[model samples]
Target: MIPQTDPKAGYLAQRAEIDAAIQRVLDGGRYILGEEVAAFEREFAAFADARHGIAVASGTDALILALRALDIGPGDCVITVSHTAVATVAAIELTGAQALLLDVDASYGLDPAQLEATLNAWPATAARPKAIIPVHLYGQAADMPAIAAIAEKHGLAILEDGSQAHGARLNGIGIGHWGKLSAYSLYPTKNLGAIGDGGIITTDDAALDARLRELREYGWRERYVSAISGMNSRLDPLQAAILRVKLTRLQVDTDRRRAIAARYDAGLADVKAISLPRTRPGAMPVYHQYVIETENREALRTKLSERGVSTLVHYPVPVHLQPAYLGRVPLGVGGLKRTEAAALRVISLPMFPQLSDAQVDQVIAAVRASV
Candidate 1:
């Protein structure tokens, strides 16, 4: 079976080198927060064009730590997109801050107009959100230029959620470099997958970086010495080694994804029922999942499944509806019209660098036929 076409296949296409790297980690006595993790952090930071990088245990932790580092806590609010992984909103709630939801736009990122309108009407109040967290949804970036402008006017900090886009670029620069602290996930299926769970935060601020480094290790400067209250979440050496190996070919792999996306755009152009993703002139989508929208999405999904083509909804529910976050997160800013609309229509196709051109054609045909 083809399974979900994953970059792991491409990585395994170069498996011998990856195996040796993992073995080297095994040989080293130190495991957590070792040389491999350090190197990967530095390499990844450079890849994102950020000055400081901090390795963490998971994507969720990355966001939580980012909130902690930003000092967003009880009684504070954080404005962000509703059309994002629950982890994004959950991270804010987990930090004792309120989650304020905003809708998305045509690009399926944040709707900057809606964001500004909400802030203009709501005016933070006693729940003044100290920050704005926008997702670079499905390898596509939100309009950072507009969001940055709004944030500046409202005096809100920006923390970009870049979990889906590893090497994704926006307006000539990478996603992680757009805001103060951007979070990334290295879940196995990501564009730059790790063997297991891993995450990182990239930034140019040295003081925040140093503090985060200390914060991940139980606030310890050395063994058994607690500098402050912190969590025990650090990237494993093995995952780091695996990621280090994967990092070498990230851009090349991203290019292959783009190639497939281009084919989909060309081949599936006539299918009027489907709405394809849009890329900014200077931005590049890593095509993490090739999310598309259709009116009869459930029918389309069932048909796709019957045809031996696997698919998933990047998210079926907006963050507001999730049970885990009830009472904590606000009911969302007004209607969240775009957010709710996307929740029903968006579907994630089998996407990865290893997905062949022919497979892309098969996917296109399947989608076209279904529509």
Candidate 2:
């Protein structure tokens, strides 16, 4: 059976191309924010359909730096999903802003209805929320159209967490271009991942773009006189080079993911006791993780494991309950009821572009038997 995921298969497939990229970076001594990083930023910006792409140290820093660029700080609250990676919430806290935890819907993204309800029910006098950070959880784009409308109505900014979605799209717009700003993770596991930590922030706003360029660096456009207390987060040239190579193959890799997902859908749609993840019409998902929902999640996982099929939980705990965000105020509706329920019941199956059809069927058979 195909393991839950394998990052190396695809990397190994293009070992020679990847090696060349690495060697090129190594030979080029300018390591930080050098030509590779600058070129990648330009290419990534074009790919995302945004005016700018600011490279950074990691996805977490991308968010933190974005917040700092927007001047969101102490006493400011950021509305966001509590069912996301702890990084989403942690980044807000790092910027000294309060994280208002929101719930996710059955689609494994932000719940539009819940988001509206929470905004309506917010206790007045709470720190006037300056922004909303909706996570594109597990590679699915959050309901950006709805969220965008809500943010506009409430004057809240949008910062998308697009860590898992490199090629994911909604209504013809890529995930990174969906919100005012999107934070992308090139962590080794992401769809268009780098060999190591890397991140980019995409935005159409020129002013914000300029600010972030300064914000991600030493805040000095000119040779480090320090314009702000910006941290030392910069994308290394090697990661940028590698990611550029990876970026070129993203569409092809995403197509393979679609093929594998379709295989799973074909095999398991009628299977009892499990509900496959759904992709809404007008959206194209990259299938970063083919997660399934079922009440008997643990049992199914155990059975799959025993059968040599690897599985993973996208997230086992809702961000609100995490110690770091404990007692945080709720941002969107009832503080993650659906998220909590989904967390307990969901399990991600084997997924990768290079997975063979035989391997797909093996995983399907194992899952069916295990379930």
Candidate 3:
């Protein structure tokens, strides 16, 4: 069966280059935070148009460190949407801050209007709102211009969760550049994935960059000194070396993903039973998942599976509705109406850079016939 995402295919596409990079790292003998990691950090920071990059052990660690670097912890409240990978909210709570969930617009991003309303009606006794994390879900950028304006007015810091949005842009500015600092997951299935678990944070502020470096490695101003409390979240040298090779072809891979998304868009446009993903004007999404919505999501998914085409739900349940968060997480005014509906209906079709044209056609036909 065709897989929903194929990281193995991505590696095989550049096996020789990736294997050589890995061998170089193995031969160096300096594994943790070594030359390979530093070089990969520099190259990734340059690609994101940022002043610095801090490589971390995983995407969740990236978010946790970014929050700590910003001085957001106990008694702080961070606003974000529940319709995202649990890592986003989990990271906030990990930093000892309360996560205030919000809703998303038709583009499946943080709803700016709800943000304003939520802030306006925030209870006087609640924790002071300190930051807003607008996740660039599914590689589509949230309304940054509007979100930024709101954050500025309310004195809240902006931390973009760009886990799925490597190379995505809005109004000519990269997604990670809009906020004070952004975090990206280099998990195997991500757009610019590494061979193993990895993550990176990017920022333009030099002082903040310095703090992040310390925070990720035992708060070390000097090795083993422990200037402040921190954790061990350094990116592995092996994954870093492999990512360096992958970074070389990120643009080409992103182009292929967009091409496949375009085919899906055109092929499925006429299927009245399903709704295609929407791209905001002036935004270029990398199409990490190419999600489609249908009220009869289960039946459609089963049909695709029976036909030998595999699909997966981007998220089967919104975080707030899950057992862990139910009746506890704070929601904005009017509740998460859009987020709740989207969770049940959204299904991600096969999406990856290595999908052949023939396979793309097969997926298109399968989806069309199923719908």
Candidate 4:
């Protein structure tokens, strides 16, 4: 069956380069945060058009560190959407801050209008709203211009969660440009993925850059000296080496993903049963997962599987509705109506750079027949 996403395919596509990177790391005695990790950090930072990059162990750590760097914890509230990877909310909570969940727009991003309304009606007794983590979900940018304007008015910091949006842009600028700092997950399935679990944070602020480096390694400005309270979250050298090789090809890969998305758009436009993914005006999404919404998601998923095509739900349940956070996590002013709707309907079709034109046609055909 065609897979929803193929990380292994990514490896196979560049096997020789990846193997050489691994060999290079093995040859170098230092296995931890060595030259490989340092080089990847620099390369990725340049790619993101940021002043600095701090490599971390996981995407969750990237968020946590970004929050900590900003001193957002306990008695602090961070606004983000409910329709996202659990890691987004989990990272905020891990940082000891309260997560105020919000709704998404039609493009499956944070609603700027809701953000304005929520701040206007925010209870005085509630945790002080300190930051907004606008997740660039599905590699599509949130309405940063509107969000940034609202943020500026309210004195809230913007921390972009660009986990899925490696090469995405809005109004001629990168997704992370509007925020003070941005966090990205380099998971095996992400656009600029590492071979294993990895993450990175980028920022234009030199002070934040230095603080993030210290925070990642037990507050180590000088070795073995605990300068401040921090945790251990360093990117592995082996993964970093592999990512360096992958980084060189990200733009080409992103172009291929866009091509596939265009094909899906043409092929599935007439399927009345499904709503195709939408791109915002002046935005260029990298198509991490070409998701479509259909009320009969489970039925359609089953049908596609039966027809030898695989699909997966971007998120089967909204974070607030999940058992771990139910009845506890706060919601925005109007509640997560759009987020809840998306959870029940959205399903991600097969999406990856390696998918050939013929395979894309197969997926489109299967989707047409199934829907």
Candidate 5:
């Protein structure tokens, strides 16, 4: 069966280069926070058009450290959508803050209008609003311009969750352009993934960058001396070396993802039983999952599976409705109508840079027959 995603294929695509980089790291004998990590930080920062990059152990740690660096903790409330990986909300709570969940728009990003209305209606006794994390879900950017405007008006900080949007652009600007700081996950299936777990935070502000660097290494102004309370979340040198090689091919891989998305759009346009992924005007999405919505999602998924085409749900459950967070997480005024609806209908088709035109055509044919 055709797989929904293939991280192993990504490694095989550049096996020689990846193997050589691993050898170099092992030969150096300096594994943790070494030159490999530093070099990747510089290279990735330049790629993201940011002044600095702090490499971390995982994407969740990236978000937690960023919140800590921004001085957001205890009693502070962060606004973000529930239609995202639980990491986004969990990170905020990990930093000793409360997560105020919001809903998503048609593009599956945070709804900016809801944001404005929520801020206007916020009770005086509520926790003081501190930040907004607009997740670039499924490799598409949220409405940053509108979100930025609302954030500025309310004096709130914006920390973009760009884990799935490595090369995405909105109105010709990069994904991280509109936010104070941006965090990206380098998990194996992500657009610019490493061979193993890794994450990075980017920012234009020098002070924020310094604080991030310190926080990732136990708040060390000097070795073994804590300048402040912090945790250990340094990126592994092996993964850093692997990511350095992968980063070089990110744009090319993103272009291939877009090409596959275009193919899917054309092939599936006539299927009235399903809705294709929608792209916002002026946005360049990298199509991490190429999600399609259907009223009878389970039936369609089963049909596709029976035809030898594999599929997966981007998220089967919204974060707020999950066991740990149900009845505890706060929602925006109108509730998570769109977010909950999406959780039920969305299914990810096969998407990865290494997928050939033949595989894509097979998927389309299977979908057409099944749907």
Candidate 6:
């Protein structure tokens, strides 16, 4: 069956180069944060047009480190959507802060309108909302201009969750540049993925950059010195080398993804039962996952699977509704009606750089038939 995502194919596409990169690291006799890691950090930061990049062990750690570096912890609260990978919320809790889950807009991003209302009605007795994390869900940028204005009005810091939007842009500027700092997950299925778990944070603030470097390695200001409390989340050299190789072809791969998304859009345009993904004005998505919405999602998913077209839900449950958070987590005004509806309806079609035109056609035909 055609898989929803194929990280193996991603590795195989660059096997020769990847294998060489691994060998280079092995032969270099250094495995920890070394030249390879440093170079990848620089290259990736430059690609995002940021001044610095802090490589970490995983995408989850990227968010945790970014939050900690910003001095957001106990007695603080962060605002974010509930319709994202749980990692986004988990990272906030990891920083010892309260996560105030919010609803999303049609773009599946933090709704700027909801954000405005939530801030205006925030209780004086509740924890102060210190930061807002606008997740660029499904490779589409959040409504940054609107969110930014609201954030400015409330004196809230903006930390973009750019895990799914590696090369996405809004209004000609990169997604990572919209917030004070942005975290990206380099999970195997991401647009610019690594063989294993990897993540990075990008920022233009030099002082914040220096603090993040220290935080990723036991708060070390110098060798074996703990300048402050931190954690062990350094990016290894082997993964760094592999990521560097993958970074070179990221733009080319992104173009292929967009082309595939366009094909799906055109092919499924007439299927009234399904709604295609939407791209906001002046926002360029990388199509990390070409999500389609339908009321009878499970039946459609089953039909597609029966036809050898595998599919998966980006998220089957909203974070706030999950068992662990069902009654405990707080929500913004009017609750997550959209988030709950999306959980039951959204299905991610086969999406990966290695999916060929013929394979894409097969998916399109299967989806058309299913709908």
TM-score per candidate, in order? 0.96, 0.96, 0.99, 0.99, 0.99, 0.99
User: What local distance difference test score does each model get?
Assistant: 0.84, 0.84, 0.94, 0.94, 0.94, 0.93
Worst 10 residues of 1 by lDDT: 325-334
Query: What is the lDDT for 60 in model 6?
Result: 97
- Between prediction 2 and prediction 3, the one with superior TM-score is 3
Candidate 4, residue 50: how far the Cα is off, in Å: 0.6
User: What TM-score, to 2 decimals, does candidate 2 have?
Assistant: 0.96
Query: What are the per-residue Cα lDDT tens digits for candidate 2 across 60-129?
Result: 9999998887789998988888777788888998998888877777778878898788778777976567
Clashing pairs in 2: 4-350
Query: On a 0 to 100 scale, what is the lDDT of residue 263 in model 3?
Result: 91
Worst-scoring 10-residue span by lDDT in model 5:
122-131
Candidate 2 residue 91 Cα shift, in angstroms, is 0.3
Candidate 1: which stretches are off by over 4 Å? 7-11, 123-125, 326-328, 331-333
lDDT per residue as tens, model 4, 198-239? 999999999999999999999989999979899999999999
Supply the global lDDT for candidate 5.
0.94
Write one digit per residue (lDDT tens) for candidate 5, span 1-371: 99999999999999999999999999999989888999999999999989999999999999999999989999899999999999999999999999999999999999999999999998887666999999999999899989999999998999999999997999999999897899999999999898889899999999999899889998999999999898999999999999999999999999999999999999999999899988889999998889999999999889989988899998999999999999999999899999999899999999999999999999999989887
Off by over 4 Å in 5: none
